[model samples]
Target: MNKITKALGLSLLLSSAVSVYAQQPPKHTYKPDGYSIVTIETPEDVRFHATGLDSTSTGEVYVATRFGDVWKLAGDKWSKFAEGLHEPTGLLVDDDGSIVVAQKPEFTRLRDTDNDGQADEYSMLAGDWDFHDNYHEFTFGPVKDKAGNYYGTLNLSHGDPDAFSLGAMGSSGGYRGFAFKVNKDGEFSPYAWGLRSPAGLGSSPEGELFYTDNQGDWVPTSTFHLLQEGKFYGHPVSLAQRPGYSKESITNTAVEVFDKIREKPVALIPHLEVANSPGNPAWDTTKGQFGPFAGQIFIGDQTQSNIFRVLLDKVNGVYQGAVINFMNGFQSGNIRNEFDIKGQLWVGQTARGWGAAGGKPFGLQKVVWDGTTPFELHNIKLTKTGFTLTFTDKVDVNSVSLDSFSAQQWNYHYSGNYGSPKMNLEAVKPSKVSLSADKLTVTIDMPLTADKLVQIDFPGLKDINGRNVGVEKVYYTLNQLRK
Candidate 1:
């Protein structure tokens, strides 16, 4: 009753503990190589649900939240810089040191008078466009051009009389669903029309403006477009705001007419697989401070709760590119991203109204590079025969084979429907695969076509050390072929 009974009881307890440990789920963590995410602590009482992010020259970070407040981050402290904004979606620290914000009503400039560290001057920069009390008429951007003009994209409203019956996104107010420019004199001019849910906007390293749009009626999927003046993107309902056209006139126009004039997007962000709600396209102007991805575009997805990289190229005078997954597993919906002076990428997150994968309501974080480069695809270029894929590091040439890569191509239909399915999908078989002498590039010879979305999967790709690449898939929007 002493030794035998105690030993039997202890064995049963240990067995139960082991069983419970095996049944528990494994902890999920995001540890991308060569980069680390540092979560920024916010005020316990404040929601800090950020919608826009920007930084000053002195390395002070500013965030505009959906709750109508602008907060500044200096060192490790957060302070309210301004308040009473009407749901600001984008913020810009102008060259003049004034904070210009794209709020729901208008673009407002906030100036910190007397060096009080708080903005006391609230002045309107541009408010020519009309706005009703609709909740969906959000404005994004205020990205400045080289000519000193400020640009903002207006979102289509819901519950409007002129709203398209297909996608339900409409522009009852003037200039809704359009990109407008505010001149230095504060004169407002409509620049480009036919944008639906233009959530993110950014200027390329060359000062060329680009915008990201969500998938909806008239939008096949999430898209990134070069914001050229007078170019119609895709949504036909936005035509009602054009001169000589009313709601009835636009409704009577054929969809073919709009299709013919619709400008192609630089890249189509694949739905579900890539991003459902993509935010700002922040270019890595860090100049190698953020590792090998200098000059590439880093975009955060609000719904996916992740950041992806875009490598852009110009073909036949048009902008097109590929998107590769960069980092994932944020704490909330990553709505805005800004690169600070130290080349660290600050991500502002929110999950209000729409749900996000991160499961948190609001937060802030930054991604820092450890100076080590990961083995990944650097960029992809369309060649006359096929494609030229470059890598950040040397590749294991022995692991390269025809079976290591597979590809498919498809296009979306232009219509009044909500998010067309991938049409005419077909497998693309490569005829030849060649590794470059430097082992940093791969050339594939295949039958190439124009005006299609090409996806290449290289799950078996490895670096010179025989380690797998960081990202295994690449989605390229092929609008043109090389001459």
Candidate 2:
């Protein structure tokens, strides 16, 4: 028989061979000092779960919750700004101050028709999902790349019930996940295929998309797969051997599929015990050529309750491989796991499901780098900030603390306060500004001062260990308003 025929004939055999090898738990070294954790207030003090968070250029915070709700963090108070979502996972704001949410199986554009704070109607931007069965568990992303196109992922929660009795292993036919894109007019189309549970989705500085998947609980190892356009990262039949299948038979079939996906992934994190702490995945884009992380990918491991950094070494235009490790830990032993955002090498995490301080189960943390012979920061942008500041890469937020800018002048620096910056810019109106876990933006208000010079500093930004947080600065000359 031909290659395809031969592979199919012994597909069951290869599956069994892969099963004999037990998956070992991946090691994650602790870096408690890499991050500066800051807790933002939650809407419901009694009970709340933060699903999605993003900042605007003006510094307003938008946080999505489980109860079909979106909360805004302004100053110290939380307010219900948007509602009627069925498990919001990803949040993004457009240049027009419009908000978009990926509410599993649906990508929704929430608009406030009357200029009211709350969204009046939920406009279906573009989503083609079978929401009835995979309603809440599936993860759909509405992330807009620098090019303005929207991308999202679909996740399969559980396998089919009949497949279990039929000697089938892993997800079989019930729910197959894929990635898709939406046009400007809200048309949904398939982008890529072959994903088990792609939960977290984000793009790197190089315009590559990365996603996290939850393999079947029965499998020995879970997987974190990366994608380009239409590549399969091995799932369902590839990760685990079928229950009654022959090892040699399935192994051959899997090799062919593995080859296709193996090259696409920047790294393969072996998932042992609880999906290997898989959560949101992002890329660090905060370097102007001086440092170790000119092009690195960052992700969060929920199971270990830590954030991970995957450094990529590309040789001759091809990605040779990557080095993975724990970037930082949160709240002593608390699970500061999942919902990750990145600035450059600096990573921000949202605290969830743990008895820790800082916004308990809902707040933001900043990871920064210290400038020395080895580290540097450049290509920074205020980007979209309001309630949060979304960077092209991860940044040290603690060092960039806000103390309300004074008209006279001030001196501020980073003392491990997330290696932010020295200058602080305060809004003319406290209510005009908002904050979130990672983004900051300006809304409605005109620019401040003819020559508004805002400076931010970071004194204690560190690496994985407790070192100095690096310094990276961006300047925006604010022009006075025209009367």
For each of the candidates, the C-alpha root-mean-square deviation to the true structure, in angstroms, is 12.9, 18.8
| lDDT score for residue 136 of model 1 | 79
Candidate 2, overall lDDT?
A: 0.45
Cα lDDT of model 2 by residue, 1-483, tens digit: 111111111111111212222343334444422334454445445334555666666556676654467777666777777775666667777667878877754677777889768777676676555543433245556677667779887665433453321122333332335577776767776676656556577766666666665433222233444566645554434233323444344444543444444323443343332224356665544453213445555566544445555434343353322223434344222211222232323122333432222223444444454443333232222222211222233333443333322122122221111111225446332223332344222122223343233222223333333344333222232212223
Candidate 2 all-Cα RMSD: 18.8
TM-score between model 2 and native: 0.58
- Would you estimate the TM-scores of all the predictions? 0.92, 0.58
Q: Per-residue lDDT for 95 in model 1?
A: 95
Best by TM-score: 1
Q: Ten-residue segment with the worst summed lDDT in candidate 1?
A: 10-19
TM-score of model 1 vs. true structure: 0.92
